[model samples]
Target chain A: GAGVSQTPSNKVTEKGKYVELRCDPISGHTALYWYRQSLGQGPEFLIYFQGTGAADDSGLPNDRFFAVRPEGSVSTLKIQRTERGDSAVYLCASSPLPGTDTQYFGPGTRLTVL
Target chain B: QQQVKQSPQSLIVQKGGIPIINCAYENTAFDYFPWYQQFPGKGPALLIAIRPDVSEKKEGRFTISFNKSAKQFSLHIMDSQPGDSATYFCAASNYGQNFVFGPGTRLSVLP
Candidate 1:
């Protein structure tokens, strides 16, 4: 693709429902990342994947939040038992090699949990 | 703890004026500093970037002033315009690591 792509630009789900958001990164990019942004706040890092392995998942808030990159090209973020507090914009970004290279971000998925 | 801190949750600037956004970081290991601009319903895009070795870098109307000793950096927009109104984020990163972003500052340029 020309740029990173995210699925379900907007999602509305009731509390306790399970939701999955997908991200397709640029072709052959070695690194991919996920972030969450709340109203009036900066994007918070959620997790980062280097190739087929998750190099850093320290930013994952809790057990309820999980992400995976099986083939090193596409990734998925899963939220279990979503709560109202989980409502926020989920962003996905990709970089060539996860170093000094710039990251291209997707349009983001705005999840509204009520 | 937040690795980077930004100031002025919101800023209002008049047309033709210069708007400056400041950021400070505690991590000395960060060598790459970049600023991103984001519009409503859009993802953040790289506006400019600077390396630790350079004290300042300018690209047209945008300039980045870096103070390596103070662990601080700032973005200056010259001749601000209404179209420039958006949210700006400052971020820092070390080699092969995740970029840490500041809280972000909203800039509104009134025509």
Candidate 2:
């Protein structure tokens, strides 16, 4: 039984560059979520998907931030025109269907925009 | 505006002592409350959770006291150990989006 996993543990890029962070959720979990954590702060909601479709994307800061879970199992968060303000730890979480409100989290990818 | 507010940004407690971290939310619609524990470089792990119907829920040494009337909740760790030192976050459910989390509390339990 593997837990959620994220790729590119640490990524450093210049401003205006594009970066993609991937996440693999637990097997059989039908719901996935993305969050961002800034220094000394709580994780902020980004988006969440139920199955292959995003149920909510309101938390996404702007059009430059987008995510997809085309297969309902793996997801990728895409950021365009990265800004120093976007630098943070990107977190992925998943939960079982019928909604228990408990989400299992991955180690996260730290994005640094220089 | 932040939906949830948590306090004592950080705390230090001696082994065998109890440490309490409190959180308050402005949104009354929040239905579920859960606490997460995270060590450096590690992902957050669910510790304990409570629903609005109940005033208190205890599992092991961790306890969650919910005050629906006050729109607040508190996490209490009993007989804490040095191993318990970590950052703790309290979160409230936001319908389908998972949650709105409070600013985390960093706990350092000294042995």
Candidate 3:
């Protein structure tokens, strides 16, 4: 794809249900990131991946939240036992290199937990 | 602690006026500062960026002002237009670190 792409533009689920959000990064991008944005707030870092390894997962709120970049090109963010507080927009971004300053963002998936 | 802090949660300006949004950072290791603009439903797009070595950088109607000493930076929109009404975010990052974003400022350009 010419740009990053996210699946399920909008997802509405009930509390305690499990959900998965997928991201397809730009071709050949070696770095991928996941962020969450609440209403009226900026995106907050959730995790980062370098190749197939998670270089940094410190930002994940808890064990219920996990992300995997299986082949280093596409990634998936999984949430278990979702709560109402989990409602927010999930953003995916990618860069050519790990330390690159610029990251191209996808349209983002708006997740609503009722 | 919020690594990056932005002020004036919201700002309203006339179409032809200039709108300034300020941000301050606590980490001195940050080397790159970038501003992003986002409309209601779209993802943020990079507007302009500045490095610590340069005090200022301008691109078209958008300019970034950097203050290394005070650990502050600001975005100045020149000749603001109604189309420019959007939420602006200031972000900072050092090598190998995740980009940290400020709270963000919502700007409204009144025509």
Best by lDDT: 3
True contacts kept of each: 0.63, 0.65, 0.67
Error of 1 at B64 (Å): 0.5
Query: What value does the lDDT take at residue B56 in candidate 1?
Result: 98
Compared with the true structure, what per-residue lDDT tens digits does model 3 show for residues B18-55? 99999999988888999999999999999999999999
**Candidate 1, B21-47: lDDT as tens digits:** 999999887879989999999989999
Question: Which of candidates 1 and 3 reaches a greater lDDT?
Answer: 3
Q: What does candidate 2's lDDT look like per residue over A38-69, in tens digits?
A: 98999999999999999989899999999999
Model 2 steric clash pairs: none
Clashing residue pairs for model 3: none
**Model 1's DockQ score:** 0.70
In terms of docking quality, model 1 is medium
TM-score of each: 0.96, 0.97, 0.97
Candidates' C-alpha lDDT: 0.92, 0.93, 0.94
Taking the tens digit of each residue's C-alpha lDDT, what string does model 3 give over A1-114?
489999999999999999999999999999999999999999999999999999988889999999999899999999999999999999999989878878889999999999
lDDT of 3: 0.94
Model 1 TM-score, 2 decimals: 0.96
Order the numbered candidates by TM-score, best leading: 2, 3, 1
